[model samples]
Target chain A: MDILQALANGFEVALQPVNLLLVFVGCLVGTLIGVLPGIGPISGVALLVPLTFALKLTPESAIILLAGIYYGAMYGGSTTSILLNIPGETSSVVTTLDGNQMARQGRAGAALAISAWGSFIAGTLSVLALMLLGPLLAQWAIRFGPAEYFALMVFGFSTLSALAGKNMAKALLATLFGLLLSTVGQDPQSGMSRFTFGLLQLEDGMDFLVVAIGLFAVSEVLMILQDKAPPAVQATVGRVYLSLKEFTFSLLTILRSSILGFVIGVLPGAGASIASFVAYTVEKRLLGSRARFGQGDIRGVAAPESANNAAAGGAMIPLLTLGLPGSGTTAIMLGALVSLGVTPGPQMFQQHPNVVWGLIASMYVGNAMLLLLNLPLVGLFVRLLAVPSWFLIPAVLAVSFIGVYAVNNNPFDLLLMTVFGLVGYVMRRLDFPLAPVLLGLVLGYLMEVNLRRAMAISNGDVGFLFSSPIAIVLWVLAGLSLFAPTLLSRFVKRGALGDDEI
Target chain B: MSNPTHRTDRIVGVLLLLLSIAYGWTASRFEVGMLSDPVGPKPFPYLIAICTAVASLWLILRPDPDPQWPPVSFWLPLGLVLGSLVAYAYLLVPLGFIVVTTLEMALLAVLFGARWWQGLAAGLAFSLVVYFLFTAGLNVPLPAGKIWGLGR
Candidate 1:
């Protein structure tokens, strides 16, 4: 079926009373999680997966809810950054640069209003782009061989490791560790247990939900405990609506940043954080010395907010079309999809049109819901900041613990989650990027399956990896991604020092 | 400024190197199936082992300067939180979900510096609400207490 027909079907699924209620609930929960520190979209979605299973909703509805949370969190994330200067997630880090400044200047309402408007516009634009691009990419990807898929997976890993954090070595180590963890279950090819350590639970391998909760939720709780409590939020939020002049001034920046953010989001491993940073920098460059860019500039707030939301939408493109998750949150979403018995790939649109389109339709509904929720409810969310971390952190932990336990009705998973939580804590302390580890875990099985399949087909000839044109192109892209960071940094350094000095 | 750079890096590197060696050694013992393909399960683990070894060596050889550690005040609370989680895991199935969760939440709240009554109230309220929400509303089978039949 064509896009319009599929989307009409999707809206039918999305607008069903149950699905609509779920979308609303997802948005509400997502905003709450986003407004609250320590729990992000990853953990929020992870924590809810088992609950969705318990609810026994159809896969399409479940995904609609989860996807709602994913983008809704992006919208809610800016609230804390603007009001309290604490970014609820990595993507909101750039928002705090000018968002907090605006709060301090007592323009918190204006900043919040612009962020919501920018997010809505960018989110809508990106969803439209996804509607256009998703099918085309899926059409192209249907022709990929196992070798090409393997190369693409490699490229995903390399890009993630390269941009995951400041330390490439740490990121690489995390990726390797994740790959190792993925190898814990029975091998799909041989049915040989590689590292089950003789537990029956080990037979199924580590649940991604457990790992995600431990790594993201539990680790965050520990980190929060280690720090002092957050300071009082700035409460002088003047005028919840932006003036006509201010809105007009920021329209171009919002549009430009949205496009930039969408492109970055489509790239594997380059997520909202990077998009926001790049958008803010591009906006700064465009403005020059006309305004103090970082010092409470409304354009700075508008640009990053628009870009990050746009990027969230953009990140969905690869996931929906290629089944390759471009970011950590998308990785969790992939796990959710797999658990729901839906394998996302080029054939996903053909096989699961309702699910793919319903999710797309829900994004439209979700973005609208968020735009409404955020503007008027900004004050209510800011009030949540006063809810003590002591109480909030423990509540998150309790939810995580229960969520994991409910997955298999086993306490062992809770213990495993705790262990991973500790490991996540250590990794965080040592500055390892958590996202790469997650990416590795999510992609590891697929990578191995494709590699073994490719090898088997080629009669164990490793040369086949380099033989196909698509495979060769992907391999070259992977190589470039792996070294891109080093090359870019060197070039940046040289540029900073000027040609003669270099 | 007084401290040497990369103290944590050197320690982590050494630990990772040892882990990779152990992991590599363990991975070599997996039995290859009779009908297994030429590239078996061993290649993936071996690759990971090699990556870990190389990365750890790199970390050891060239550690990042000016690594920041959490302050002294952080350790006690961190330890408390960790210990409470472990305890919660052990106590969960036996003492039941609601009871253990309540205790664990209260303990964590106090550890994070909440007043006793405040922690107790928040923990009790939070645990009870979540328990009912999951068990009654969502149909998740959280364990009823063996000691007292509170959750069934």
Candidate 2:
């Protein structure tokens, strides 16, 4: 089917009242999660995956909900950066430079409005591009064999390991650790137990949900303790509507950043963080001295906000097309899809067109809903930041505990979660990138399976990894991905890229 | 709160190295009945172990100069929170979800400076609402407790 036809079918699925409600709820909850200081989109979605189960959603509806959260977060993540000078997620780190300044100048309303506008425009535009590009990529990716897949997995791993942390060694270690952990259950091929350590509880291996929530949610709570306290919210929402001049001023910026962000986000290693960071820097360099680039420049606010949102859309392309998640949120989404028995790849378009297209169609609807919610209700979300940390902590922790237990009803998993919480805390403190660990854990099985299949086909010849043209290209890309961080850091100061890889 | 020159990375490296060794040893001991694939499980595990070993060695040799360490004062409360979670994990089934969770949440909130009764009130309210939400709304049955039977 053509893109338009599939999207029409998708609209049929997405327009269901229950699905609409889920989309609305996901976007609202996602914005709230993003605006809240302690959790980002990854943790927000990871913490709520079980809730979707509780709702007993179909795979399509569940993905619609989760995808809403993923992109809705990009819109909300900027609010903190603009208002409080603290980024709710790494993607918004660059927003603090100009956004906070705009707020201080009592242009907070304008900045927030512009971001909502920029996000809505760029996000929807990127979705349109996704509609066009997704099929083309899927068509090309359909030819991948086991060797090609093995090489692609290597490429994915290298891209993440190289750019997911300041130190490639630490990131690589995190990946290896995750892979080792993944090997704990029975071997998929041989039924050999690799690392159960005599525990029947672990025979099925670690539930990615438990590890994810433990790493992102529980560890985030612990990290909050290190904060003396958040800076008081002093910015007032004067007016949310932007002036015509401001809109005219930022039009080109939004367009440029959106296009730039989408391209970077399509690259496996480059995530929304880089997209925003690079966007802001490029905007500044291009408009030097003509516009006040950093200090209260409305274009500054528009550039990164639009870029990050567009980047988020771009990041989903790889995950949907090649089953290679470029960012942490997409990785978690991939994990959720697999757990739901929906494998995302080129075949997904053909096999599960409703799920794919429904998710795509919902992105358009969700983006519109976010613009509706964030514009006038920006005051409400900003008010949420006033909630005392203590009150929020208990609520968050309670939700985390109940969410985990409700899914499995197993206390052993809770204990296992706490262990991962400690591990995640240490990783965060030491600045080890946590995304790779999750990605590695999620993809480890697929990687090993693909490798073994390829080897089996080639009769244990390691050279088979480089046999096919696609595989060879992927391996070469993987080789380059290993050095991406060092090379990229040379152009952009390492400081410009925040420590949070996701 | 910040360490300009920290040996913690080296400690982490050594730990990772030990883990690599242990993992390799364990992989070598795996007794497979039959190999479905030529590469089997051993090769993949070995490759991962070697990567871990190599990564750990590199980390030890070139540790970042400035790695932030946790604050000294935060350690006690951090430990307390983790301990409470572990306790909650073990106690949830025996004490039931409502009773155990209420206590756990209250204690956690109070440790961070919520008034004692305020914490209790919030905890009780939170737990009860969540219990109904899960059991009634979601149809996922949570444990009421083996000892007191507080919830169904």
Candidate 3:
């Protein structure tokens, strides 16, 4: 009863005309970002963080807008994959396999329709799951002490590092690198400078936004320069409607993949890309020679399309409930949340239920808006694909620079951003994961604070970290995350690995 | 970078190791001022440095196969693009938001293959649009031009 009452109040906040309009605009821009190749939700939201602050919207409205963009992007991401055989983003990479196959056979209409429908169904289902599950998780997390929090974050970093980049070593290095960056400012507890290198600007610590926009958005511009532009492709959506038989065929696939994806997404480090690939593989094995997986099967489009959207919804559970961001985009969202003057954690649900539920309720409305928008306007987004890399890439960079400058009006941050951009570009080429560095940076301060707090509480007894059963469980999970991938990786293609860290 | 060998990994490994050592060395010297908290700020940095050292040592011992870098020619233009950003940083106050942003975008357009005048027009249009959005809609202040003695 309390849950329904809270969600209803959330609906009240979300339905305000201004909030509705923000969500609509967020969805529209999000789809554009998704339809474009070489840019993803991380860059899109990273560019918006400062703008959102400058706009002076309430934290609830800001979150609603950003959340709209996050899922709306998942919707638009499938368009290029189905039409051009180019995934709009990494999460939709699997869609390219079967999505393009359908397009080539003149069934692009059915593929697009089915994907929209599946995304709609799974998105709604996963939000429902989040609604039911989020409060429960928060309640459990409310009992955490500093020791439990420390152990839990260690678990998060371990899983993320092990599963993220080209190899565990590179990923761990990125994680350590991020932790080092987080320690640059004066230590809050001791008031001692850790690694300021004597720079006065660093007293407040490295701003995550400057680094993120620089690394993800600015580097994307430099990256486009290295490769020639995508050649113009000839493709069309014939009818944009799925036959009843096609609908029935993919319905079961959508439901199954949505469930599978939600569970994968709820894990600490696992995200949409993994859920989609694993769902596709599982469907392939389930069909056992009856299903055509890689060559434009309807179920192929259904599996990843729904799974990724559902995973996006599922990924939010940890972020809202536990203040843990499992993937890169969510980490950026976490940054947005922090900037909005909202601390994300167990208390968020109780202290700012309007922000919490408003965001949740907005996703439902946003998903509906996306289904309507995608059904008719797939052509509009596809036309946007013609935007030359020369034009779009520069525009994106301009936004990154301007937005970072707007945040503090500091040119030094701009220089710092450029440095990170080059660093990000090189790291990508070397196959070092970028997300863990972000994850480490975002989570590092909290991890250090909690570890120090636990140590203080325990009077420097190292055994206190392992003292609690919850802490023990978290440590064990951390170990499993490091080892489980090597054991379970045989099921996935090597191509489907690594880059999913996004 | 030109040769395309495992040495990229080794070089990166050495750099990381140096960073680890540098971090560790600096962290070890922090004077314990508080003596209030049971464990001061030193342990976390030590943990991070040690982790980096271990990871970098592994990378050094067992380097991965070579990853091919983009063509060497990429450096000049890449530098130009990155340079434009840094230049825009210092120049924004002096040259103004409109002038610096226009130049940055135009440089990007021209570098990626556009006519200079077209790039200029496009850059001006985009910069003006952002200018209007910020000043008119959000009521936010942006530097006009310090040398011109414009809006403070």
- All predictions: root-mean-square deviation over Cα? 2.7, 2.6, 2.6
The true-versus-predicted C-alpha distance at residue A102 of model 2, in Å, is 1.2
lDDT of 2 by residue, A364-460 (tens): 9999999999998988888888877777887898888877786577998899889988999999889898888888888889899999988999899
- True contacts recovered per prediction: 0.84, 0.82, 0.69
For candidate 3, lDDT tens digit of each residue in A1-502? 9899999999999899999999999999899889988788888888887878888889999888888888888888999999998888888999999999999899999999999999999999999999999999999999999999999999988988876755888988998898899999989887887788888877888899888887888777777788865766657877799889999988999999999889878775678888888888888878868898887899999999999999999989989998989888898888888877898999999999999999989988999999888899998788877766667777787777778888788778998899999999998888888888888889898999899899989999999999999999999999888767665567766656443322
Give the C-alpha miss distance for residue A303 in model 2, angstroms: 0.8
> What is the DockQ of the complex in model 2?
0.73
Q: Which lDDT values do the candidates have, in the order given?
A: 0.86, 0.86, 0.87
The superposed Cα distance between candidate 1 and the true structure at residue A26, in angstroms, equals 1.4
- lDDT tens digits, residues B1-152, model 1? 22467677878889999999988989998777586788988987888899899999988877877457788877877787778778877888779987888888888888878888888889889888998998899888898876785653
Q: What overall lDDT, based on C-alpha atoms, would model 3 receive against the true structure? A: 0.87
> Which residue pairs in candidate 1 have backbone atoms (N, alpha carbon, C) closer than 3 angstroms, thus clashing?
none
Instruction: Give me the runs in candidate 1 sitting further than 4 Å from their true place.
Output: A232-234, A494-502, B1-3, B149-152
Interface RMSD, prediction 1: 1.5
lDDT of 1 by residue, A210-315 (tens): 9989998899888777766576554656678899999999999999999999998998878898898889888887889986787999998999999999999999
Share of the reference A-B contacts seen in candidate 3: 0.69
TM-score for each model: 0.96, 0.96, 0.96
Candidate 3 stretches greater than 4 Å from native: A486-502, B1-5
